[model samples]
Structure formats: structure tokens, C-alpha cells
Target: MTERRIVSIWLPRLAIENWQRRNADWPEDLPLALATAGTHGQIVHDLNRAAMESGVSKMSRIVDMKTICPALKISDADHIGDTKWLARLALWARRWGPWSTPDGTDGLLIDTSGADHLFGGEPAMLIDIQDRFASAGCSTRLAIAPTRGAAWGLARFGSERAISKTDPLPYVAPLPVAALRLDPQTLLLLRRLGIRTISDLVAVPRLALMRRFGRANLAENPLLRLDQMLGRRPEPMASPEPPPRYLVETRLADPVMDPSDWLPGMIKDLCDQLAAQAQGCRQLRLSIFRVDGVGCDVTARTAAPTREAGHLLRLFDGKLENIDPGFGFDVFRLTAEAVEPLNAAQPGLDGEDTEGLALARLIDRLTARFGADAISRPLSYESHIPERSQILGAPVSDAPAPLARADRPLRLLTPPEEIRVLYAIPEGPPGAFIWRHQTLRVAKHAGPERIAPEWWHDRSGTRLRDYFRIEDPTGLRLWIYREGLIHDGRGAAPRWFLHGIFA
Candidate 1:
């Protein structure tokens, strides 16, 4: 088994240097300190070399620091910006390792287990990392060890840049308690107990120390850190996983200007792969790479998830004509841009009736030829109003089942036209009404179906409707309604109108 190795990179002056790089006009010789809000007031968070030389140390009051160094430059520290840059740096450092992650706000941790040989050796790899960061105007201190804790301690506090594969206790024994990554309170407590260094703490009995500081959190416990640094405890690196891709390509021996014959076979190969993964394509794109370096592509979408090869072939029809295969094509790639799980469907116990599948295929073809918006079916909407009862939606979209009612007309008018009642019974549809500049006599008539306005949705003043199915002398049927009752306190006297027409 390959021995595990990790690298830790620290940037002590990250905030100061980031600010300097962004503002090129600022003099590098000036004493600059980044300040952040503290309990009392703004305090120095980080300082440059010049500020350090001028006695402007971290945690000092910015006002006092200004007095100590008359030319001191103070700016608000951008912790978020520093962290974002550190994350990007960690991702870019993958050239030296299989996995890397941002350790904190100003550092990175990389797992370079068996990859040091690519750079000749461990020392060579560290030197390469230093040179790369130096070229990018960044100051970095890096170290490698058998454990993450040891590498982290050495990068920030230890004297050496690389530790051998042997036990790391000797290298970290003399380091201060802070190297254990403990909280400020723990460090202070250790100091009062006269345990200033790792060696001093290790000399204390483990049972006695655990009794004094209950073993609750790792941040406050020192035993966990010691065990981790000595490789007794496991510390797994949290690396990001790459996104999944579904693509297939074909390289032709000879350049062909027309890909009509090759498209079917490539599509079949892609469909077979999708079936193996138990997924069906929702959208597919075909890319054509030309020998002269020009490229063209086209896309097709389905109404529902499907892996059928015949249906997909028809969808791409007339779409490839727009692709100008410039100077012949050398590559053909088929990729599924979007996919969804499609479990194997069980066939009916009796002989299969493909009526539903055939309808879905027809809808997909029509949608691909035109556009999804151009082909839609009526979807029942949850409303009591006749006009608001249904809406247009995707042909294959999921919707609530339509409401079942009686005596509905095939055609409906948007805004019912007002009719002059020539004759009619009291509190009912007009017997003989004038509509569209013509008079129609009622040969036979059905009853008054009362449809009240929805109280929650309709306005307070909205009136109820009394609908009736009436037939004329010419065998024409009409759906008419009275706008209001004779004396419903909400509105005026009842008015008649033509609402819909029956076939």
C-alpha cells in the first residue's frame, strides 16, 4: 500500500497582499494594516512587513497604531474575498494532487499521496508549488508530512518544510500549544498549567487532563490533535466530485459532407447506453465537427421521457438540413443534455394496445417540428367561472382531471352579448330574444340552471347567473343566461345575455 502524504500551504499575509495587488497605486513601502470590528473598536487583523517593523502588531487598537506609526494606512478587512480566493487556489492546486481543499480563510490542504514521483520527489514538488505561487505574486509557505495535522503545524509554526515518513512526534514536540489548533481559552488554560509546548502537554497523564477538561469537543481537546498528528486517528480529505456526463462520439476514417446515413447508427448507440443506465433522454444535441475547424449543431426535445429509437429519429427530421457541413465533417457527437429515470414498463397481460404510446410519439414529433408552446392541449383549471374552467398547457404535462358537469356547450363566447327580451316568462330565460340583429322564436326550452358567483373570488357586487338551454325554430340550440335575479340586493334587475352556442 502507498504511504499517505498530505501538503499544507499557508499565506500569513494574504489579506494585506490581496489588498496591495488590487490597488497597484498604493506604495508597497507604506505601513498598511487591515482592521476589523472588535468589542471596543476597530482592531488590526493583519499587517504587512513595513507595519510590523513600525510596531503595528495584530489586535492593537487602530487609533493607537495610527499614533505609533504616523503614516499607517488602515482598511476594512475583506474576510469573504480572502476565503473565495483561497478556494480557487485550492482547486487550481490539483495539478500536484488528486484532491485539494481550502483549509481555512488563508490556507489550502492537498493530498499528494503517491503523486510526488510525477515531480521527481516530495522536495521537488514543494519547490514547484512555491515557484508557481511566487510567479503569481503570492507569498506561500508549504510543507508535507504523513499526517494533515503535522503538515499544517509545520507550514504555520514548525521550523522544517518537509518531515520524513517516520513518527512526527519529534518534529512537533517543541511547537507551542497553538500548533494543536486549540481555541484561545484552551491555550490560556494550558499556559496557566505551565504546559507551553506539545512535549510538556504530552508529559501530563491523559486521565488527569481529561478529568480537568471534559472530553466534549475536539476544538477544546488536545488529546485528539496529538493522536491525529501521530497518524493514530483517521482524517479523510473532503474532495468535490465531478459532474456526470452522458456522451458518445464517432470518428470517421474519411470526411463525409452528409451525415444522414451515420446519424441513425450513432443515435442507436446512444439510446442503448441510456437504457443500460435506466434513463431516458428529455433533450438531445448532435454536434458536427468539420475538417476545416468549423462546427455546427442542432437540438431536439421530447414531450416526455422516452428511449425509443424510431421516435427520436423522426424528431430530428428536417432539422439537420440547416447544418452546413463546411468542408466535410470529421466527427459526430451525440449528447443527452437532460435525462430522467425511466423504469422498464410491463406489457399488458393481453396483446399490447399501443394507442397511448402512439399518441405520445405523435405529440413529440409535432412539438419538435414546431415548438413546445405551439402544441398544447386544454387543461382543466380549478375555477367555478365557465370561461376560467380550463387553460392551455403542454400536451403531455400532468394536470388535474377535468370536472364532470352536465349540459355544457361545445363552443363558448368570450364576452356574452346582451339581448333584448322580446318575450319570456317571469324569472326565466326570455322566450323570444333579439340577438345579432335577428329575432329567434323558442320552439322548445329547458330549465334555468342557477350558477352562483364564487364568493371568495368574485367581487361583492358580482351577480349570479341563471343559464338555460333553448332551441330555435330552425333547430339551432343556444345557451343563454340571466345576469341577475329580479331583486338580489347586490345589483339591478335581472338582465338576459347569450353565453354559449351548442352544436
Candidate 2:
């Protein structure tokens, strides 16, 4: 088989921010920024090339950044917005090649072997991609080569002449060793030894170089031998495409202001779109875009792959109210976030197993209204401590597969509290306990199921605990615990705590 060439694209920070600002209605000529606000205040995380030349760099403190560019127009980073646009771009770029992956935060790669002709050949495709992005206000570098490494080096450090597939090495040779993706220490050492360019490193003997740098240095050492540099080995491309799936979008002609007037219809439309797109897919994500510019998204996952419109819609009923068509939503999009291969198992002859499906729908609706995390099913874990053993999991799905042991208490305190006992057994269960300012006499008790401390994770340095399930005079079930062991002789008397109650 002939060697398969690769095309690597790089969109530096300055380029990406410019694109975002232009698309978001900001002045195209003015310096722009995307920052994050934290306790220390706003910090610049990304800047366009103009801003960079003006001394603005990634991770620059807000105060310092202001000093560098007083007229900087800053916008809080919108990761979600960026991701949505990236997905769209990746989808569009798929027309250029069979494979494409996002490069870092602002770049993309395309395997252009068989698809270059459609864009008027390799050079034309490169120019076309660059123009498309530039039209969108994005600055981009496009490089094509026989290897990912070569493409990456050329795109970021190689001059315009280096981008051509033919005679690529001559252009690539002049770039610094950093293009090889070498670590700082190794690059520093190489520089000290008069190795400034990739060509210089290639001239050195591989064994002698390895001996001086040590084998560990080879890790991330981008220098490649003749055969390796020429792309003889397999180099996999991580795709930038938002996995293989379908998404449905609805753009309202006019933004609806009244929730009562728009919510039901909007939700119905979204579900219909999702159902149609998810023909054989199992997982779905629904994103709602409100007129105010804020967006809300939720995901619905099923035990098996499904495309049934009714089942998918019912799953989202609970979350519809939360959509908050803020100032009325102008657009809504539904995407299949994940999918599993379908073998098309034949349905049973009866075809009427609606009970499980009905329950799933109810759960989905409840989750939609209260938030996906609001409703959940109890799942048991392997721990004697009441609170540690049972967990609340999403309601739309069953508990984790290979369900954990179910011997844990039914109810657990939000935070276990200390309790005083009037009558207690030093070696066994307590006779009476005082909890929440109320004292109750324990009529019966069971368990001293001693649970050892997970020392590997005992950050608190507390010792093991012995737990017990005690019944009070009113037949109320209580889960209590005592910390440490008298026999261990490591601390004071064991302290008592009330961890949970059984309904």
C-alpha cells in the first residue's frame, strides 16, 4: 500500500479569539480577549495575535493584562459555546477528508489523501480552509505532509514554502527543535550543545544522542530517525468530529416570550427532531438556546440503543420547564452524543412490553423538571458504614451494572451527627441513645459489624468504626456507629454517631 499523507492544522490563541469575537458581534479590528473570572479576578486565558504582539499572553493576570492592553475588550470564556461551534466546524470540515480531529483548543487535522481533488488539489484545499476560517475571522495555519509530526512542525513553525507536500523537508529543516515537541529540559540541553534546528539533531548519531540524554529523554523527544521521520510507522489521528451521531436544530422565526405559550410546543418539536435523528442511536443530548444568549443542556441515555420518538420525548418531559426560554428561545438543538452498534435483535412476537418503557419515561420527565440530578435511585456500595454504603444515582437509569450488595440501610443522614447514649454496652450495642435533643431507649440491637478504616485514603487519620442497627421503643430503626476500638488503645473512648434512620 502507498504511504498515506496527513494534513495538520493549527489555530493559535490569537486566531481563535479573533474568530470568536467576529462571530459574536465584536469589533473585528480592536484587540479582543477571552478570559475566566475567579477569586483573584479576571485572568486572560486566550488572546488573538494582535493582543499577543501587544504583550498579552495566556494565563496573564488580569491586572497585568490590563496594563498591557488598556483598551482590551474582555469576554468571559464560554467553553460550551466554543465546543458547539467546534463541533459544527468539524462537521463542515468532514467534506474535505474522511478523517478530522481537533488540534488542541484551536486547531484541526484532516487526512487529505483521497479527498484533496474536490477542493481543487492540496494547495487549493489548504487555501480554501484558511479562507473559510479567515472569513469567519479565524487565523489558521495549514500544513500537509507524509507524517503528522512533519505536518505539525510545518504548520506552526514552518514558513509558507514548507507547506507543500513536495520538498517539505527543506522548509521543515530550518525550524527549531521545539517543533519536534521536545520537552523544555531536552530542548535546553540540545540548544546548549549547538543543536538549534531539526536538521542539526538529525545529523547526530541516534545511539550517542540516547546515551547522553538517557532513554527516558526519548519520551516526548520529537527527533525522528530517517525512516520514522518519513512516516513509515503508524501514526493515529484523534478525530475532532463530535463522535459519529446526528443532531437536530430548530430555529424559531420569532423568539417566544411566554413560557406557557412556547414551552410545550418547543419541547415537542425538539423531541420529534431528536427521535428522527436518532434512528439507530441510543444516547441523546438536548441543548436549548434562549433569546438572552444563555443555554441549557441535558442528556438522556437508555439501557439499549433506541430511536423511538415517544420513548425519547417522554424522557425529556420532566426537564422542559427548566428550559426557561429566557426572553423566549430562538433556537433549540438536539444531538446524539453517543451511539452503540445495533445488531437489530428481532423484537418479541407480542411487542407489548411497555411497563419498563413507561417507567423510564416517567423518570425522564421527573428528571427534566427537577434537573437530572434531582431524582435518583438508591444504589448500595460495599461498606458497613450506612452513609458510605448507599448512593443516589440518576433516576432515568437503573443502578450500576453488577449491582453492589443491597444490605445497607434504606435511609442515610445528609451528614452523620454525633449522638449521646444514656445506656450503652462497652463491648456491644447501646441500650439507649440521645439524638437531635431527643432521648430514646433501645429495645433491641444487632450488629457490631466492624468496618476498618481505609488507611490508604484516611486523610482525617481517624480509626476504624463499629456500626450497629438499633430499634427504639416506637419500632423506629436507627443506624449508629462508634469510632475506634478500646483494644487498639490509640485514642480516647469511642465516640458515638447517628448515621441514618430506616423508614
Candidate 3:
């Protein structure tokens, strides 16, 4: 098998030119530069080669830069714009390889083993990439080798070398110590020791070199060692492409004005498309692009990796209505964000889909149509108070089925309504009370579930609450709470509040 090689391409002056190309209105012939104002209120960080060649280095004052390049057109560096374009670049580079990872401030690494043949081998791939970049008006230096360090060195140092897979060492050897990406101090040390070129350092014995410069020092050195150069050491690769998976997209022939008309179909189409592509994928993202170019995205996750079209479609039904489709959606895309190996399983002999996967899908659809929080499963909290003991959690596909709670009366008050009690016990439920402008007699009642307030949260200075589930003569079930204990010195007689009514 041929040795797999990692290609690293560096664009030294990418930022400055990227800015100029993005803003086409800017004069192309004029020497342009990007600078930032310093703390002293003058331009700092000149970002143009022309400006630098004219003696205007980084952190140079605006006045000095102008004095050197009288015709230089300078603008403030757009860091946000740079980042956005960089992401686009990364996405575009994903077309060339299965793995493409960013390198430093302005470079990209492409894994070429499985991908190189598609572009007619290494040299053709490089030429294609170079052509694409040049067409985009960006200059790039391309290098390929068995190691990232070697590739990086060649890209930055071997500028004059031919763009081929020939031995990279000959090209990298002539470069200065700085090309190794060593710290300034390290480079200064190397210079002092007369170790000017990478070739000079390569001549030294490994043990002696390591002993002179400790292991930590060697770790900081960016130069690839001979072992790595010869493919002995594995070069770690950061995958630039997310992964091969499924994606669904919809482009409207005409702009959509209302979400209701198009959302369901768009979602269904996206889900179906994604399912078709998923094959062995796990997670899917639903992306909606409005006519105005704005994007709204949501994710549908599964317990295990699945490519089931029906299951995925049902999953998205839960969140479909959440998409506004704003001012008319022109495009919709569903991408499988993750995946796992598919495992076939046999159905149970009992033949019951007791998993409640269907119910979960129903809940997801309901939540999607209404709102995420609109549908929920009751969760128990470690509290005695009825309201405090129970909480609502967002509908999830993988949560264990909830056990049925005891039959309770419908209609619980929010912040249980306070009432004048006809009969009351110092430590128990009230027998009868005037509530909601009506005197309700308590026919049956549950005992007090005294819940102490978390003392650690006493910074709020609120008293503990005691709760009781009370039933009225009219079959109304109420969750009420009594604020403050009998002897807490924070005097304001205990107050009763109606929280909720159970259905």
C-alpha cells in the first residue's frame, strides 16, 4: 500500500487580499492595507505585504505607514468578516478531501490518501487547488508530505520548489529556523548556536540534541524529526469535513410568504431526503433558509443511529412548526450531523411495539407543532410539595417511560389562592375555606408534606414552605402552600397561596 500523505497549504498574505477581494469596490491596483488603531489612537498591525515592504511593519503608527507608502489605502481589519470567509473557505475545501483541518491563522490541511485519485493524483490536485484559490484572488503555497511538520515547513519555506511529491527534506533544509514555527526565544537560541537551517539541526545526534534541549523543548519545536519525516511517527490529522452522512435540502421555485403553507411539505421533504441519505447516520439537522438569506436551524437526534425515513420524518414533525419560514423560505436543508454503524435486530416474538417509540414520535410532532415546551413528560424532583416534587421536561425520544401517577382531581391553582379559613389546624390542612370568592368546604384532604427550604439558598431570605393537597366539596383538587414556620421570628403570620389544580 502506498504511504498516505497529508497535504498542508499556507496562504501567508491571505487576510489582506481576502479583505480586498471581498470588497470588490476597493481599487485593486492601489497598494491596499489593513490596520487597527492602537491604544495611543493610531493605526497598528499593518496587514499588507506592500505596506510591510515599504517599512510599515505590524504595530507601526498610521503616520509612519502613510509616510512610507504615500499612496497606500488603509482600512481597519474586519476580524468578523475574516472569520466568516474563513469558514466558507473551510467548507469549500471539504470538497477535496474526507478530512480538511485549518492550520494556524491562514492555512489548511487536506487528507489526500483516498481523495487524491479523484483529482487525478497529487500534482493535479495541487494544481486544481491552486487554480481555484488563484481564481478567488488569493495566493497560496501548497506542500504535501508524510508529516504535518514537514508539509508546513515546505509550504512556508520551500516557496521556490516544484509542486510535486518529491523528497520534502531537500526543500525544507534551506529554510531558516523561524520556518519551524519555533518560539522567538528558541529561534534566537538556534541562531546563537549557528543552527541557521533545518539541515544544520538534522545533522545533530537525536539523543545529544534531546539532552541539550529537554523533552519539553523538543515538544515545542515544530520541525518534524527524521523519524516523522520518514513516516515513522504518525501525524495527527484534524478532520476538516464533518463526516460522510445524509443531507436533505429544498429550494423553492418561488419565495414563500407564509410559513404555514410551506413548512409541512418542506419538513416532510427534508426528512425524507435525509432518511434516504442517512443509510447509517445518527443525528440530523433541519435547516431553513428564508428568501432574504437568513437561516433557521434545529436538530433531531435519535437514541441510536438510524436511517429510517419514516422515523426521521416523524421526529421532525415535532419541531416543524417552530420554523417561521420567514417572509418566504427559498431553501430547506436537512443534514445528518452524526452517524454510527447500523446493527440489525429481530423483533420480539410477542410482536408488540411496546417501546412507545411511536408515542415519542407523536409527542415530538405535537411539540413541533405547538412549541418545544408545549408538550412535556412529568418528572419527579426530590421535594415533598406536590408542585415542587413534579416538574415538566421537554419531550425526548429516549427517556424511560413514566409510571402513571395516582388519580387526582383536575384544576390546580397557580400560586394556590389564599382564603379565609372557617376551620384550621396549627399543623394540618384547613377543613373549610373561602377561596376564589367562594367558600369551599374541604370534604377530604392529604396531610402536610413539610418541605424545608434549602438553607444554602438562604441568601434570598425567604422562609420555608409546608404544602398539602386539598380536595374541596365540589371535587376540586388544589395544591396550596403555607409560607413560614410557626417559630421562625420572621413575623408576618403564615400566608397560604394556591399554586395549581390537578387534572
Query: lDDT at 177 for candidate 1?
Result: 85
Against the true structure, what is each candidate's TM-score? 0.55, 0.47, 0.61
lDDT of 2 by residue, 132-217 (tens): 56655556787888777788888888866245454456766788888876778877888899999988877888788767755454
Clashes of each: 0, 11, 25
Q: What is the C-alpha lDDT of each candidate?
A: 0.81, 0.66, 0.65
Error of 1 at 241 (Å): 9.6
| Deviating ranges (above 4 Å) for candidate 2 | 1-5, 12-121, 159-178, 182-228, 232-281, 286-298, 303-305, 309-354, 358-370, 374-394, 400-503
- Candidate 1, which segments miss by more than 4 Å at Cα? 1-8, 37-42, 49-56, 60-69, 80-102, 109-137, 143-151, 158-175, 188-200, 215-217, 228-276, 280-339, 342-381, 387-503
Give the root-mean-square deviation of each candidate in angstroms.
10.1, 12.6, 8.1
Against the true structure, candidate 3 has what lDDT?
0.65
* Superposed Cα deviation of residue 444, candidate 3 (Å): 14
lDDT leader: 1
> What digit string (tens of lDDT, one per residue) describes model 1 on residues 1-503?
99889999998778887777678788768989999999899999998888999999999899999999999988899999887767667655665674889887888898898989978899889997887676556788888889989898889888646654668888888889898888899889899999999999899999988897765588888888888888888877787743226777776767898888888988898899899999998888887766543456678887667888887888889887877875677667788888999878866777673666667778888888887677777678877678888787655533333554669885789888889999878766677989999999888888788888998998899998888899998999999988887667877778888888887
